[model samples]
Target chain A: MQAPVLGVKALFFDVFGTLVDWRTSVARESEKILGALGFDLDWLAFADAWRGEYQPGMEEVRSGRLPFSKLDVLHRANLVRMAPRFGLENLSDEVLDDLTLVWHRLDAWTEVPGALTRLKTQFRIAPVSNGNISLMVDLARRNGLPWDAILGAEIAGDYKPKRQVYLAACAAFDLEPRQCMMVAAHSSDLAAAAACGLRTGHIARPNENGPGKGEASPSVPVDVAGSDLADLAGKLGV
Target chain B: MQAPVLGVKALFFDVFGTLVDWRTSVARESEKILGALGFDLDWLAFADAWRGEYQPGMEEVRSGRLPFSKLDVLHRANLVRMAPRFGLENLSDEVLDDLTLVWHRLDAWTEVPGALTRLKTQFRIAPVSNGNISLMVDLARRNGLPWDAILGAEIAGDYKPKRQVYLAACAAFDLEPRQCMMVAAHSSDLAAAAACGLRTGHIARPNENGPGKGEASPSVPVDVAGSDLADLAGKLGV
Candidate 1:
């Protein structure tokens, strides 16, 4: 539990479900975009169904069954596959493309901006997410998320929970893994990053999926833990 | 004359000469650091000597004489090779490493900060330099460059003046080359980018190499040209 978080030079973030609340944002985006197209359906379930394809899609790349494809590409393919199940058949390519980009337009957790601004004062900050470069860019631009670099899956040419993704991000900053901290809401992500020798900080995004549906606390040990990014920032002495 | 500069979505900058005055900055840094240890030489010439190796070093990778190496690695090797001439032979690895990082400590031109801030309101801005990610991050943090992403040679796995570097940057943003403008002070850089279908904007760095030694104007045609970054920002209607 006593990892050296104080001397960390970089903060590598897990974007989805950590910095951003994808469930409500995606549900809202789906409702607005698809609701206008005369599609009356359970948008939250639609959001859940779309997100449900995330792991299996990544597992394909992670297992080496398929070559490394960006998260955006995987999101699109997953969207197309699950579209029929929601009775949303024969959606135009443009519409499908628009929906796929829902991931890019998600809103950040409320306290993330202030925490990140404070954290940037002391450390290099970047997204170490499975999201592609462009997706991260759109989200940052939209939400004023001040990232020092867009790195991770696209830069590593591999997905996260894979050692390369975490290591490549640290290497990109020319810092040792122990000199960097991986901050995420998910223990699995933190565990993977920890296994790669990175210090772990947890931000409890209890409502990441929906009210009371996300990780409210870390199940595993971490160097630091906080109820939100602002608390995490304070905990880190930033 | 018309390359659709108005519709450009992203601005990819050439950092060394275009955004930062590397020669003066490096010379000052070298004198301050190395002179303290009692080694003296014509530091301006020293800066030039270090930069002088840039093209040949990159050409090694470009010509496939060597595999792709980050600009920092090439710079360190070049520094080590040239050190003996300046009576800097047998320096410890730490000192050599510190000297090589001079590239990461360069200052932005006087008007660059304001111009980039103004331009950021309308476009996504990032360095498309051959400089590695950490170098870009360091330069940005030092000078408040405000880049949305640190991308270029390191992410592209190759050096600029290469078509892949420019194309890969565009691909990283999911943007077409035509939708992005390559902004640099060097005509060769602009021309190479133009060949890859990117529009070009030139900001004259009249003293980038030395007084009257840098590009006062684009040698080739460009979509836009200006006295400096502020002028370029104005010309681009930002």
Candidate 2:
């Protein structure tokens, strides 16, 4: 692989499974909250099941089958659908709401805070995730990630893999798509952003979805690829 | 007056006058930049004239006379329109562009940082100004405002005092209007938010418009009124 030259002005990140370790965080929180109520099953699988609904739920909006609803609302409906499968039923509405918000409390990958702080000194940084504004805000506050703004599905009124989400985030910064880099662990996200003319930087998150469920590298070519955000920042000369 | 009981969960601020001293900052920057370039005029009046175009510019979009453009674009157009009067006509595009970005560097009012840091412990805080996302982000970064997200005209695709802009910001937080307090130095801003059912907190910015041109207090009733952010935070028991 040759060293790539890029002129990126801002970096837009995919939050879930990219900057944050959502899988483990969700599993841990599920066990802590649900275990307290004596509803103990395969917590990790429960977490996976909850996350499995994410894409299909988004597809409903992307396909225009439903008007855009925020990720929190979708998460709640997903949680209800998966609740009975895990011996959890009839939970109070408040408790169910708290469990769904586990996504908002996900812990960041170890190097994210330091790397992002370094990146911010050189380039504008924001999360262009599918998560809604309140969820993104909660996650940023909980983890100390210094984002310039929250940009994503909520503001775009559409989910990614959809081109409007990528284009809208760039428009928010008044930058051409080519001037912004999309950083993510998932190649598909980078691919979607790249398709919209954003530069793509890939970060390896081998443990993003438990041990064996995550990809260790980008499955496709990107402008830059590195082991993590710190490495990516170094690669970009930040 | 008896202390007003409030159950506010979030505080949405009007950034330009309420939190930051934009009039002074813009005038100072204009004088420094344009003075260096050998143009002379009443710099403060130049700043006022520039801002004076803001509401009317927004009204163009609010009335559907023009499609929604970000505040930065509108500011640029307004700057160009006022340039000849200030002996700034025929400046290079780069210089004009840089001048328009003066809004990004506005200094926060003296009590903002400390008061907001204290208030953050109790509520979700954000700027619900008409400034676009990029402008708000740059201003927040320059002034050390710990905003959870940037929300306003750009995100809402319409400027305030439009009801949709206020309602959109509240919706971003999944908050009821009554649960969010709109904080501002301008009565009309508060009045607009209040009409949308939001609670209001008035901050006195006596020098907001380069002295005497600005109001020192809300012209209408509000749930809370204070001398500055620190006073407001104290009044709110933060």
Candidate 3:
């Protein structure tokens, strides 16, 4: 399918599953933490369950079913509820606090840093994810992800698929929507960005759900599509 | 006098006259533009005259003496009034628009990027300047300065030495005032940050005024003092 060629001055990325593999990384780190605590549990199951709390939590706030809250607060609330379900109990507040920070320890995809470096040479690159500023900043520092700035839902006062979130980024950079591009693995994200007049690029992360798992195919008319970041970088001539 | 050792988590910089030698840089850039247009005025004098407008312009906004304005707007206003002084009359709107972006092209101190790199490994480094977000972002990109984020007076709706501007940086990083350090060559800037409970580090840019010229030394009680960025880094053990 032919896609429109776009002229983009800046690129905003979706941080979690799109730029970094949060699932496996969080699971591995949780497993290590459990091991250190002399406990055994299904790490992958815990990771999926932890991530399962994210969407509904965001939806709750987005729909005004709950008051405006930061992602860290939401993550902490979900962690407290999920701890006992994982056959873990009697955790001190300090331990729970450290565990809640699992989201901060996400691992970047192998292709992420190099691709971002190449793109940074040609365009303004930043994170326009639903993640809060501190979480995103910590993630970038820990993973060596080079971001020009952190533009997130906190600045938008709303979650993804909302025009406000996308527009907030454009406003922050003082660019018209057409001058900015959104890069994501999720069709829903690109759809929202495209609807808001931002150019879109889709980098397929087939392994985002692990082997034999597939995310829904992106349905939006993105300006570019590639199997991975390197392909996207090549396509953009970065 | 022995200064108390400060434990600083992040180093927030003052951009315009602190990290960037704006006077010299702006003078040189404007000279080139004027030279191309066959103007033969004293470029240094013109640059100084142009910069002289910055403070009064900002003060007008700060004192509620004028309506709220972005630095870009203020800069443009100043540029329009100063243009004829440099013999650049009847300039086309497009050329004038380009000239107004002179603030976006300010050059960084020679030690800025290298010192920032070293500090970044240990602390979150950002610019808490009066420049707007877009201006700071573009400046960092243009000069290859590795800033973790750009926190500006525009975000706080007030310019520095204002308490809100210093406190806003602390709030953005989720850091307490004492945990953050304000590093600047200007005593007034550091004093304001100190009043907000942030530790202050003074890096003496004796040559900020360019060759054979010097920046005025103002008295302020900073936690540390160093001769240059390299010295600051050394003192901080970064």
Candidate 4:
């Protein structure tokens, strides 16, 4: 309810569910691919299941149970395994490669780019995503994300919720961790960033899954919270 | 001469000499600091010596004679040793810190931003500098360099003229080394990049030392050569 404090020099974003609607986008793309293959399945559930793979897959890498690899490589590895379960038949390597790049072709939430443009006038904006730099760069160029830079877990050889990842971003910007704010829809990311001494902002993505979809509340108290990026920008006076 | 072929997708620039007039900038700042202390020295030569310290300092790190350190840290360590030689006296920690950031406050060559803007429309423009990321980011933001991203040798744990530095930029953009181009005033930087399979462009910074001073030419053959950034942009038809 109260106005958010200013003086944050850089805003690090959680890319997937925060700035972009990955679930809907991935489901739609999977549906199209399935249709093209003359097959059908519950694409929505498949999309959610694929999304669910992210945290655990990253855990494997973080725990050294898996070899060091890029998010794109991990995404592709997951996709190849999930394809048959989702009724994808006889997918060619070229087709799978194109599908892996679907993450790079995600649409920005309608309010995202506009809010980012306004924020860019006053602050440095970058995505602190689990996605690799190349994937994030391609996504930004494709969606006009207007990121001043792309900060990724790849930069630190680890994923989010890791203190080193957030510290790496602060180091890259030459700022104390407290001077940068992590903006995300997820509480885990905000909590991790906050624990690492960063300020935090929560932008609720109520329609992140569209009509009748369940929405969860952030589990931690962030420095600020808002309904969307537009509201967050307004609160930050950008 | 004939029009240069220009199918380069990304431009990886040499920061210190290509975009920024480090000689004048560093000399001016060093002179101001020395004057405040009532010391006198040929600040221009001092600047050259300070610049010269960069390579050997990095070579120490590169050759494993010294531990890996960021350029700013390396610069500060060298400056502490070189300050007495420059007749600087009573330099406190704060003064040393301010002096170390001289690299961060560099002024761009007058033609840089405009040419970069023009080229950005056709190619991804970034600085592939030996400078660290934080220093380069500050320089770009302060000087309005319009870099799409900052690629630095610090990210690769080594300095330029090394293959890993060039390969890091290509990896960052997810491009084949040949798809990217190294744009530098120094032919040797371009040669190093080319040896890594990148394309190369040379924009002659004849006034690299300001109005009357001259330096030895880089001892390598660059792929494309032009008078300046405008001339280079024109050659690239950007």
First chain of candidate 2, TM-score: 0.96
DockQ of each: 0.88, 0.80, 0.65, 0.52
lDDT of 3 by residue, A1-238 (tens): 2235456789999988888998898898887777899988888888888887888889988998887677888888888877789777688888777887888899998888889989888888899998887788888888887888888687677888779999988987888999898999998899989999999989888777777454534676788987888888888876
Models, CA RMSD each: 1.5, 2.2, 2.7, 2.7
lDDT of 1 by residue, B144-166 (tens): 88888887989888888989999
Ranked by lDDT, the better of candidates 2 and 3 is 2
Ranking by lDDT: 1, 2, 3, 4
B16-91 in candidate 3: lDDT tens per residue? 8778888878888876776788877777787788888888888988897886667888888888887887667788
Give the Cα lDDT of each candidate: 0.91, 0.89, 0.82, 0.81
Instruction: Tell me, by TM-score, which candidate is best.
Output: 1
Worst 10 residues of 1 chain A by lDDT: A1-10
Instruction: Write one digit per residue (lDDT tens) for candidate 4, span A1-238.
Output: 2334555889999989898888888888877766686767777788887777777778988888987688998898888777777666578898888778878777888899899989888888888999998778766776777776677698888888889899999988888987899999888889999999999999887666656452345679888887888988888876
Q: Model 2 interface RMSD, in angstroms?
A: 0.8
TM-score of model 2 relative to the true fold?
0.94
Give the poorly placed runs of model 1, Cα more than 4 Å off.
Answer: A1-3, B1-3
The candidate that achieves the highest DockQ relative to the unseen native structure = 1
| Model 3: per-residue Cα lDDT at residue A37 | 91
- Evaluate model 3 with DockQ and give the value: 0.65
Question: Judged by lDDT against the true structure, how good is candidate 2?
Answer: 0.89
Estimate, for each residue in A30-118, the C-alpha lDDT of model 2 and write its tens digit: 88898898876898899889998999888999999999999999999999988888877798998998898888899998999999999
